[model samples]
Structure formats: structure tokens, C-alpha cells
Target: LIVCTHDLAVTLTQRPHHLIEYLARMKKRVTFLHLRHLYEQPRDKGSPYIRKKVKIGGVEVRAIFAPFPSPLLNIFRGLCVLLHVLLFDKHRYRVGINQGDPWIGFVFYILRAIGVIERYVYEDLDYNPGGHKNWLFKRITEIAEYYSIKVSDLVICVSLNLLRLRNRWRINRVIYSPNGVHLSLFSRAIKKKAHPPTILYIGSITEYFGLDIAISVLPSLLKKIPEIRLIIAGSGYYLDDLKRIINKYPEIKGHIIFLGRIPHEKIPDLMAESDIGLAIFPPSELMHYACPIKIFEYMAAGLSIITTRGTEAARILKKYSVGLIINYSVENLKEAILKLFMDGCLYKRFSMNSLKFSVKHDWNKIFHDEFKEIESLYLEYVLIHKRTVS
Candidate 1:
């Protein structure tokens, strides 16, 4: 069973895609339990718990949706989840794979203790506590995460930094599984044109994502390279705030374009149209451990990048010479953009290196390599359990 806090159909995003692909490749019979509001089909107005069957890449999948909407209602959601498992899922699932939802971990822990779940794996992709503003909520989240890490049989972290943090929990197994890109999706050869240079920023427009920093550097960038354009894509809580910020800067009005929330399939064409990619995450504990998927996508699309220092992805960018890493400041960002814009040969070299580095970090290769070792252990456990039962 694969458990996630986000809706599997609508907001699965990149990390979940990797997990789904892994399950499909391993040909594992799996049930996906989503414990969140139904964002994709908000008008359903049906039962709180909905069940359906779906197929992905010829793999059969059973999906169950249980809406919890808010963390304050976790107790109710936990009851709903426990009831569903006891009524329909008991003795049917061998392992439970949770995708880093601390709140939902409570139910999984209980299921494991009661023999309903034989094994549990917790996949921690991000440090989410830094994003929560309410002190009570943050404390609750921290406690839940601590218990989740302490109780899981295996812990999979997305970065070395995260793995190191989890080591303090004395977990039985902790594996580093970084974010990866779908190389084939962005491998199309794009012809370079002599039109105005464009810088692209694709991801959520959240305050911590540093979209404002990108906007702050636009005026200076336009002054250095008048033909330069900034294309801001993706939508989030800060969309209207970003628009207001852009409106404040009259000089950059015509030079900036906003393409709100581009579909995942159309991102490659958007990448092909741009010369540079911006991936600036503000300095925060949450971002320090982040391996942004956008960085890998930028590399896969063969675009030079400008990212803030101290992130796990920035280390890879710096190591491969695929992009520039600078401080999270407007001045540093402006300088980096100007330098890349002024040096055509350097940009081309970085672009080539980006593509070269991305090939080794493709999602298919990463999952195959990591899961080969993991599945062996899982199979042994399954065989042992079968023998004991028989």
C-alpha cells in the first residue's frame, strides 16, 4: 500500500511519479490511499471516502481517497483510515509505503502495531516544519515526524543532508534517493535562435521559492541586456502578490511575461523557448535539505541555471559546472544573470554539461538502481513470513 497526503491523480507531482514508476516496474500489486481533500474533483460531494481503480503504464492500481482537508482534523481522518483498513484492507497488504505525511503516520504506526501491516517504509522528501507558521501546529508536526522516523522499518531520504538528519533516529535502514528527471521527456533537440534572451522560472510562486528575488533582479537584467525577457510560470499562494510586485516595477512591465501554471506535458516546449532557468529558493531550513525537481528538469532541458547556494541541488549544479550558484540576494542574482547573458560561449558549455549530467540522474535509472537492493530485502521478508504462516 502506498500512502500519500496529496491527491494521487491531481497533485502527485514529481516525487510521487517516481514512486508510481517504481511500483509499475516492480510489477507490485499496490493500493494508493490518499488522505486529503479532493482538489481535482471538488464538486463530487460524495462520501468522504471514495474508492476507484486505475491503470498506469499497464500496471493495475487501486486508489482510495479519504479527505482530511486540515491537520486539525487528523484524529477524524485517522479513524476513517483505520476503519477502511480494518474493513477492506486487512490482511491484504504486505507492506505500507508512506510518502512523508507525518499526520498520517499515526495511523500507519497503529496498523503496524496491531499486525494489520507487516512492514512500513517512510519516504521523507522534504523538511516541512520550517514552512509552518503556527507554533502549535509546528510542534505537533515535529512530534509526528519524530515518531514516524522512529517507528518505520526503513527510511528513504531525498538528500544526503536529510539522511544524516534521520541517522539520529537510529533507523534500521536509511537510504538516500534524490530527485530525478524524465530525460526522454525533455531530450528533444531545440534549435537555438538569435531572438531576445529569455530567463525561465517554473514552480510554485510561494514566498520562500524566491520568485520575488527573480522579479527584483529583472530591472537590472533588462538594463544590462535590453532584449532580455523573464518568463515566470506556475501558480501558488503568492500569485497575486507576485503580480503586484511586477506592477510596482514599471520599467520591467513589457519585458516580463507570466504563464500561470503550465501543464506538465507542455513544460518541455516552454523550456525549449527559454535560454536560462532560475531556481532560487530563499535561505531556510526547509530549503537547505531540498533537492528541487525543477533543477533536474532544467538540466534535462539543456538550459543553464542560476540557483541559490546551500541547497542539495546547488551542490550538484556546482559539481557538474551545469549552472551558477550565488547567494540569495537580488544583487548576486542580477550579477549572475548578467554574466550568463554576456558570455555566449560559457552559456553553451554549461547548457551541454547540464544535459550530460541529467542523463545519469534519469528517474528510470535511479529507481532501478535503488530498488534493486531494497526489493531483495523485501522479498526475503515476504518469503520468511510465508514460511512462518504455512
Candidate 2:
């Protein structure tokens, strides 16, 4: 099989290591890899990890990492254009993924010209519109939706919210593959931590994630348990606002720690060090059907969770007895945190249950099942297209 994917499996970003490992394991059957933009650069401060060449199942993979080029140099950009112009094959199976407009447009023309393209799969991992309030994300997402729905043979979404997003856009043939974690990677903890515990909030501190709620409830929580501290371990647009809130609360000024944007690999260590994991999102269209990966990560860490009620993520938490589920209010949130401070047996139960529950939803099992299903469907679609053309 020949796989055509975009910048998705970029190294050191979005768990590309896991995908590379999985694909390399399948080399006994795979013929070629048609990848576009296989690597991604960090937002600033350069590449996230040290570059290395490692063999996965003895298969050497080619990586193309340049997204933008310095006009003075321009060599990488020039090479990318050259690859777009020159790469070709007449009889191999084709799978066009979320490659940018240029690559997708070129593949559509080439596949139609030679007429051997089997299936076109559009996989959307980031379907959150509120993720970026900027113009760049909006414009690119709009164009991606246009071509992805207009030309793909199958559309795959990593979350159920994305499937609903497809239907809203009037795109059919959507499949849901919810984001998952590797249960084995999680540190199994038999004993739970003591009361007046340390609380943790991971990921972005943006408006969409409701960092305000976390900040507002803190003063009250501190009055109740002065020993408590809320450690925020990520950075985003709302970082400044969150900092201001912390500054305003003089009693708990030092109690709030901001560890700006640490490496993703270091997140597990941070979680393991903390006693409670926190996720608080306000009500919105996006939040309604969303299933956050943080919830699973918190569970994998075996930390008792505190989250908003009524959302899909909360419902999942409620089912698993993972942690306290409360509505989006300062009083309610303060109460929930107090319960953990006051009740030891409840925290222990939640901590134990969360780790045990997360085992069934590991990424290895989830992705393996997804890949097999997609491969089968894609193959059948190819055969049907061939017969119809004949």
C-alpha cells in the first residue's frame, strides 16, 4: 500500500513517533510512502527536540520539515516546489491526505490524468474552531474544509465533535477515531495522596479552555485551605490574563505557579508530581460534543480529576467515577475542590478508578483498530471505483 499524508505526522509534534512506529511495523505489506510536509517546527525558539535518524522496524523514513523559508536562502522552499513539480508514478495505489492546497490540487489533477488513484482520505485532527482566534487558522481551516469535503473518498475525524462539524459542513462519509492514550505509559499508583493536596491544570490557558474559571475559584479555595496551590503548566494567549488574576489575589500570590510552556514529553512528569488533575471548559457549541485528550491524560496519570458537568467529557468522567463533576460556577468549583480537601476516601477511590479505567482506551489499541478498518474500507472503495470506470 502507498500512503499519502500531509504535515500531520510531523516529528516531535502530535505524537509522530507513535505513528512512525505503527507504520514501520506494517512494512511487510506497505510498498511506498508518499508523504508531504512530514515534519513541523515549533512556534518559536526553534525545533522542539534534537534531530536524529532512527530506524523503525528497519525502515528508513524521509522527513521534510520546512514550512516557511527565509527569502535570502530559499533552498528548502525551492526543493519543495521542485518535488511538487517532478514526483510521479503511473500504477501505484494513491491516498491523498490533508496535504496543503498545492499538493492536494496537484494530486487531484495527476490522479485524474493517469486514473489509478484508489481512495482519498481526509483526516481532521484539529476541528476546534475556537482554538485560534486569528485569521491564519480560520482561512486555512476554511480552505481545508472546502477541498477535503469536495474531493475525498472518506473523511476521518479524531473526535465525535468533528463528525458533527462535517455534517454541519454537509460532508458525508465521516468516521470518528477519538484521541487516546497509551495505558502502559502511565505510572500505576496504588496509594493516593493526602489532603490539602496540590492541584494541577495542564494544557492551554486560553479563553476557550476557561482559564478564567480556574483563576476565579482560587481565592475562595485558598481561604478554605491555605495550603492548597494551583500549578498551571502550559502557555497560551490567556496567560497574561491568568497572571493578572493571580497578582490580584495577594493572599495566594505565591501559591499560583506558572510554568510557561514546557516540552510535551515533560508533561507526564509534571502530572505524576501533582496530586489532582484539573479540566474546566465553559459551555459552547464546540464544548458540547467535545472529548478532551487531557481528561484521558489525567486519568492515565492516576490523578483525581475536577471538571465541569453536562459536557461530553464530564459525562465520560461521571461514568468512570474518575473525579468531581460540577457546573461552571465559582461557588460550585470551590465546593468541589473542598470536597477533595475534606474527603480522603473519595479521592482514593477516584484515583484508583481513573488509572484502571484508562487502560481500555490506549492509543495503540485505538489506532490499530482504526487503521485496519480504514485500510479495508479504502481497498473496497478502490475496487468499486475501478469497476465503475471499466
Candidate 3:
């Protein structure tokens, strides 16, 4: 059973979606409880819990719509989960996974404590305690996370820096796992010559993410190589900021392609056509811990990476001998882009290295390393969900 804070079908995702697919392939039954986003809740203020399946085409969801934001949202979610526990067999799930939000972890901890779930794994994708702006909510999440960590059987951290808190308390059962890519999906995506020397920046558009820096270097890059193209995909809180940059430099509009919030499936196709993948995030202590899924996906598709200096992405690239890393400046970015274009051997070496790096980091291998037949170990107990759930 998987309990996620966000809708798997609707959000700009990576981790939870991959987990669901991985579990299904192992022939384990999935019982999904999707807590809809605040905006997705019912407008009839009183009638907020609109429960049903979203378009998770293959997974069977015993859906329960969570109402709009309230201090008791987590409590309401816990009640819905409890209802499911009462409706179905009490010990229906052998293993339970909680994705996102520390509050959800409290529910899983309770489930584990009472033997409702045999094992509880808390996958901490972003291990940031100060991520929430609200002071009260931040403290509440810290308390909940502290409780969850104490109770969970395993705590998976996506990046190395996530180990800091665990180290402080000597905790972090510490699964140092990174994000992965569906290699077969990239294999099936037909690569076409979309344009001349294209650089792709496909991810949630944000201020510190360096989309503006990519735009700023374009005119200078175009001076040397006229056909240099920039493809910017994905939308976020920083879309308005990026648009302001684009508006200020209207001449670069024709040189750039904006494919706002591309579907998850279509990302591989974009990766295939792209020559360079830009992950130019600025310097930040918090960002150093980030394991950007796009970087792994870029490697899977054999796209040369150009990441900022001293980031996890840069470290991964340098470790694999895949791509270039430089300071966060327009000139440095333009030079890196040009260098890949000018040096054939260097470009080929980077591309080959990326492909080789991807083989080991494929979703299958990563999950296998992390799970190690734990699914099969529990499969015998889950022969049939004999108890029906409403």
C-alpha cells in the first residue's frame, strides 16, 4: 500500500510514480490512497472529500478526496485511512510506503505500531525542515518528522546531505538512494533531428534554477553558431519571472522554444532530440543536497550535461566523466555550450560516458539494490485481498 501526499496522476513527479510502477512489475498488489491537492478539493466547502479514482490508468485506488487546507487536513487523512483499515482486513498490507510530508509519516508509524502494516518505509525525497515558510507548520512538520523517523523501519534519503539529521541523532537507517530513469522508455522514444544544436532545460521553472541565465547566454551563443536553439520546458512559480526576462529581451524569443509543462511520458522524446542538458542551478546549501531527476534522465538519453560547479549533479557528472561543470555566469555557460559544439571528441566522450553512467543507474537496478527481493519476501502473504474495501 502507498500513501502519498500529492496526486500521482496530476503532479509534476518522479519518485512516487516510479515506485508504483516498480511494485506492479514485481507482481505485488497496489492499494493507493491519493490525497488530492488543496486546489483539487471540492468547492462546496462542506462537500470537500470527493473520493474516486483519478486517471492512474493501471493502479486501483480506493480513493478518498481530502478537503481544502485546514490544520486538521492530516487528521482528516488519518481518519480516511482508518476507515479503510476498518473496512478491509486489519493486516491487509504487509508493507506501507509514505511519500511526501512528515505528517503522513505519523499515520504510517501508527499503522506499523499496531501491526496494521508489517513494515513502514519513509522515503524522504526532500529532507528540508525549513522548506515550509509558515513558522507554525514548520515546527509541526519537524515534530511529525521526528516521530516518523523514530518509528519507521527504513528511511530512504535521495541525496547524501539528507544524512545530516540522521548523523546528528545517529539515525538515517540511511538508505542513500538517488533518483532513477526508465531506460526502456528512452529506448522506445524516437529521436529525431528537431533543430541544429539544441540545448534543453526541462524541469520545474524556478528562480534559482538558472533559466534566466540560460536565456541570457543565448544571444552571445548565437553569434558564433547561428542555429543554436534553446528549448525550455516545464512550468512553476518562476514562470512569471522567466517571462519577464523573455519580455525584456524580445529578440531572443524566436531562438527559444517554450513547451510549457510537457507530459512525463514525452520527456524522453525531448531528451532524445537534445544535444545538451542544462542544469545550471545557482549556489545554495539546500540545493547541494538535491538529486535532480532530470540529470539522470539526461544521462539515460545520452545528452551532455552542463551543470553548475559544486552541486550533486556536477559531482555525478565528474564522477562518470559525462559533462562539463562551470561557474554560474552567462559567459561560462555560453563557453561550455560552444565547447561541446567545437570539440567533437570531447562531446562524443561526454555522450558515451553519460550512456554508460545511465546503465548502472537505471530504475530497475536502483530499486533492486534498495529493495533486494523484499517484495518477493512478502508476496506469499498477499495472495489475495480477500477482504473487500469500499
> Evaluated with lDDT, which candidate comes out highest?
1
Misplaced by over 4 Å in model 3 are 38-51, 54-59, 67-91, 133-140, 188-194, 373-390
Kindly list the per-residue Cα lDDT of model 2 for residues 231-348, writing each as its tens digit: 8877666888877877777877777788877655667777766777888878765576667777888898888898887566787788899999888888888888889868999988
lDDT of model 3, residue 107: 76
Query: Candidate 2 has which clashing residue pairs, if any?
Result: none
Report the lDDT tens digits of candidate 3 across residue range 25-128. Answer: 77656677766655742122222113355423345565555665465475576666656665764446778877646766767877767778877877767755
RMSD to native, candidate 1: 3.5
Pairs of colliding residues, candidate 1: none
Candidate 3 TM-score over all chains jointly: 0.84
> Per-residue CA lDDT of candidate 1, range 54-88, in tens?
56554445555565466686556556667777888
Local error of candidate 1 at residue 297 (angstroms): 0.7
Cα displacement (angstroms), candidate 2, residue 106, comes to: 8.7
Model 2 spans with C-alpha error above 4 angstroms? 1-17, 25-93, 99-117, 128-147, 164-172, 188-196, 385-390
Query: TM-score per candidate, in order?
Result: 0.89, 0.74, 0.84
Give each model's whole-structure lDDT: 0.77, 0.63, 0.74
Residue 57's C-alpha lDDT in candidate 1? Answer: 52
